[model samples]
Target: MREAAEPRRVARVILLDPEDRILLLHGHEPDDPTTTWWFTPGGGLEGEESREEAALRELAEETGITEVELGPVLWRRYCSFPFAGRRWDQDEWYYLARTTQTATAPAGLTELEQRSVAGLRWWTSAELSAARETVYPDRLAELLQRLLDEGPPSVPLVLAPEIV
Candidate 1:
């Protein structure tokens, strides 16, 4: 049997506007620009930080939007993907946050992000559902629709594993 790799715990934010559009960051591998995907704003927790703490900190760092209230965990997923030059096995927790500020100034990106991130955009659920380009978490459009209709689930929903 193959041994499973240890998963890195990452906190991610599902940032939504009052109009219910979701925010996503567009990124590509530094060495392979053609390989691109849209993902939420978040990163691995540092030290012994709580998931909420990491989510809030990553939100501010990645988008320059702060002073927003964060809601409960909305979703969870285990994913493995190749990024930069290494393969990552990640266990990700998704938190819901709302923001009126849409302008993003990614001033706090680490060197890796600076090299990999292409841009950020706001996406409506319809757009996401119809998009042909790659987006992380696979079923984001359906997930957002459910969240909009029912709010956060009592327990975070476990998403399908994404391997890419």
Candidate 2:
């Protein structure tokens, strides 16, 4: 009998800017619970592809930013949980990226439900305090606060730029 393959590692960028704004995306898929809510922009790493390449692809796909700057990842982690008697697999990767020039709305997305997420808004640290409930109840808010207080982190903030 053949053994099942192990889940590969993946990395994503939880992009932020000097303005204290973190890029949040709202994917409007019915099957996706966080569709309506805001979460940092990022996705999975492809086979044998560099983390930097995957980060660029995922960021472009989700946020429609063709231009980005990739900085050293701010966070790295491995998370696993099961649902409905099946293993839910995800190796989340988070990088802290920022854009050099102003950003434009995503031109078009392949996903159907994610289309309605045109409501891109920038939230400051203070604003996050008020809208804390809108995000996942994890260390995200706390991390943001720490980043804000300390300013340009001693660690590199993942920075990415859009290129055609």
Candidate 3:
């Protein structure tokens, strides 16, 4: 049996616009375009940065929206998956954020992201709930509706771990 690899810590932003729509990036594996999904804007931390800082930085880098109101983490997730032909185990913190900017002007995207990302879109809760394409952190629509209706949880909710 193969030993488990150390999990990568990632900070993700659930960025919502003034219209109550969430922004998601469409992306595929670097080597496999057919394997695709839509996900929140975020990335792994850099050089001892706090998750909040990483979350904000990633939001700026990935979405090109800098004016943001970062909120407390709404969820924590653990997932093991394959990307770029390699298995990745990630321990992720998902923060709730709001922005008025609707346009995207990505500032700095890693080579991997440049190749993987196809586009960005804002989706309403209803649209997300009915989406046919894959989205990470399963039950995103349900979770998001909860956030909209009740606001951020006082403590971060621990999501069920996933392996894909």
Whose lDDT is greatest here? 3
Q: Candidate 3 — which residues are off by over 4 angstroms?
A: 1-5
Q: Write the per-residue lDDT of candidate 3 for residues 17-94, one digit (tens) a residue.
A: 998999999999887789789998998989999999999999888888999999999999999988887898899999
lDDT tens readout by residue for model 1, 33-134: 788999999999999999999999998988888867899999999999888778999999999999898888888899888888998999998899899998
Ranking of all candidate structures by their lDDT, best first: 3, 1, 2
lDDT measured at residue 60 in model 1 versus the true structure, 0 to 100: 90
Each prediction's Cα RMSD? Answer: 1.6, 7.0, 1.4
lDDT of 2 at 4: 62
Worst 10 residues of 3 by lDDT: 80-89
Whole-model lDDT values for every prediction: 0.91, 0.60, 0.93
Model 1 clash pairs?
none
Question: Considering summed lDDT, which 10 consecutive residues are worst modelled in model 2?
Answer: 155-164
TM-score of each: 0.94, 0.69, 0.95
